[model samples]
Target: MGSGKRSDYLPEDERGASFAQIPTSFGHELRACLRCRLVKTYDQFRESGCENCPFLDMEKEHDNVVNCTTPNFNGIISVMDPARSWAARWLRIGKFIPGCYTLAVSEELPEEYQNICADNNVLYVPPKRT
Candidate 1:
């Protein structure tokens, strides 16, 4: 009688492998300006959060701005600088947020990113308090 062959359920090499490697060059280690969409590497940043962006010279949009839940809110407020210029030149107005700025929170934020919020003025409202 012929003996039936037993199948190996798991791959020999994959059984102990940790995981796949993340791509190195997908991004250039650069941060893009949220307003003018300028991409600058870490070395080019003027300050911790500020950079010299081409769009910084462009106009701004001040009405109905959006922010996030931050202890400081300054980072978000700095973002509004561009929008304020946009409103003044195009809309011919001032005071972007007569109403409260819209705040949105993601599932989780990186520690550095969270620090940006912590050093700025923002009202953070979580769905549920921990």
Candidate 2:
């Protein structure tokens, strides 16, 4: 997850097998694995289903790394209607409709987006959409 020239560090044998889900200027690479908390996207981490996941860090957390899902990320919660909004009433999503999720991930990303994807830093903190 470092010095790989970034682009959200996908290349764990191309996680999510080449992404492009059509959600705007840069809004969905969704990841939240901080030690297998599991919230993968980007075509479900390249269809290998996040193989050897070991909490891969697609970024947006900090404190170095430890199984890495960016320490249970704390930024994306974009539920639209798991049944009727209200933030999906504690979403446990099986199949989604409106997207962008990951909130109760066990806690970490608070220190200014932690490091914002340090080594492979592509820098997108609140900077995706145009």
Instruction: Give the alpha-carbon lDDT of every model.
Output: 0.25, 0.40
Clashing pairs in 2: 16-45, 16-46, 17-46, 34-69
Query: Which pairs, if any, clash in model 1?
Result: 60-82, 60-86, 61-83, 72-120, 72-121, 73-120, 73-121, 73-122, 74-120, 74-121
Q: State the local distance difference test value for candidate 2.
A: 0.40
What TM-score fits each model? 0.22, 0.26
Q: Candidate 1, which ten residues in sequence have the lowest lDDT sum? A: 62-71
Alpha-carbon RMSD, each predicted model: 23.2, 12.3
lDDT of 2 by residue, 74-96 (tens): 55655544447655454443223
lDDT of 2 at 4: 54
Q: Number of the top candidate by lDDT?
A: 2
* lDDT accuracy of residue 121 in candidate 2: 45
Estimate the lDDT of model 1: 0.25
